[model samples]
Target: MNNNLPEKQPPEKTDWLLFPQEISRDDIEKEIKKTPIAIQKILNYYLLTDFESKYEEIHLFLKHFNENKKIPIAKINNPVIYKIIKTARSIQRQIHKLMGLLRFREIEGGYLYASFTSDFNIIGPLSLHFSRRFPEEKLIIHDTKRRKALFVEKGKLYEVVSLNTLPSDTDEESFFRQLWQRYHQNISITERENKKLQRQNIPLKFQHWLTEFKGSCALPQLDGNRENI
Candidate 1:
């Protein structure tokens, strides 16, 4: 999430009715509860979008929805609302793509490590996922673009930090990485290759960290296995 909604101020020239108060923690919590739980989820996801004006769009939609309290937000035909919904879906898509693309290799001390880049700030979501997926494992997922790393251990998300260095990969880890690449290369059918479709599925922006395309994502339900790292 962008994490700036609380600091977002109304435009100076806007009608007072539209934005009566500056955004605050109390205001957002109150507004979120006024809507259905499902819509509330969408609102949270909307904040994950990389849109430059997402806060403005969110404020606009909330104002509109308030004025039309008689109608459900889902039934409203507002452009801002539509944009919020679309962008939220896009956020989910990126998360799903990262889940499939992330490749972890065992580093020194048996810690799993994977690094990838994303335009959106998504380390929080990714941590929720891997922490649950590999509950007992100690791992790190690095968002190289943001220079942040999420650490997961004993089925719980740990501190997010700016890592200056990572554990070194051992000879065994390097061997497996090469073997995986070789297997991937040999499985390809050159005649059936479609570069355009390949690019569409795995954009160059996301390919840098994928072991297959030459890269890598999110949260899963932790089943009764939570423990301190």
Candidate 2:
């Protein structure tokens, strides 16, 4: 071995030796400003085209906003975010609508099935009501919009079945509906004739759920149906 041994190879160089240090925000802003006009336009447009872009805009806006003091509408130019906001508002409007619109047909296998054409988020609240009311029944509400099904099976809740799955009720369900209609009709006073009060009691959209609604003859069998209880 050589006497000096080449100074023990001077320890291997590390990435930190050659790596560039982080630039100051001012320097970064200056460099970003120097970026081509077309490139800036492309970056701005990137914030416009997609949902992820909105997240990116939010991230960049929050990141740069303190020092930058102003975020150009151009930097965060997302019409999609507006669409999402509008959709969210629309969903809020439809919460009561879904509450009214959802039709749960009790089936033979101790299951409650319904098809909902709304956001999956709405199902969380809906499930709370249904599961509380029908704790014993296995419930499934499929959202056609998301192509996913929310199943409350044996008291557990989650999504299932990406593919479409249709549900069916028993033939006895029709006979039971007739009996319920008769009961409803029997309870109604023909002499009272408060059409306005009746409408207020049950809205037109919920007409389908009413067993006595002129054309809906399929009243569920109320007798043994209480077995679930």
Model 2, residue 44: C-alpha shift (Å):
24
lDDT of 1: 0.76
Per-residue alpha-carbon lDDT of model 2 for 1-229, expressed as tens digits? 6676554333542222233444354554454455456434333333322243344333343334333435553344444334434444555555666676576667767667776554324666677667776777888876665666778865678777564545466656556657667777778878987889877766675554444674554454445655554
Per-model lDDT: 0.76, 0.55
Candidate 1 clashing pairs? 128-219, 129-218, 129-219, 129-220, 209-215, 209-216, 210-215, 210-216, 211-215
Q: Which ten residues in a row have the lowest lDDT in candidate 2?
A: 8-17
Candidate 1: segments with Cα more than 4 A from true spot: 1-21, 50-53, 69-75, 215-229
Residues 1-229 of candidate 1 have per-residue lDDT tens digits of 7866776566773434453445654566577778877778788888775676566667777877778889877788877888888777877888889988888988998899988888677778888898989999998988888787888999887766567977787656665567677777879999999989988998888877777664210122333434531
Predicted structure 1, TM vs. truth? 0.77
Give the TM-score of each candidate: 0.77, 0.44
TM-score of 2: 0.44
Give the distance in Å from residue 147's predicted Cα in candidate 2 to where it truly belongs: 3.2
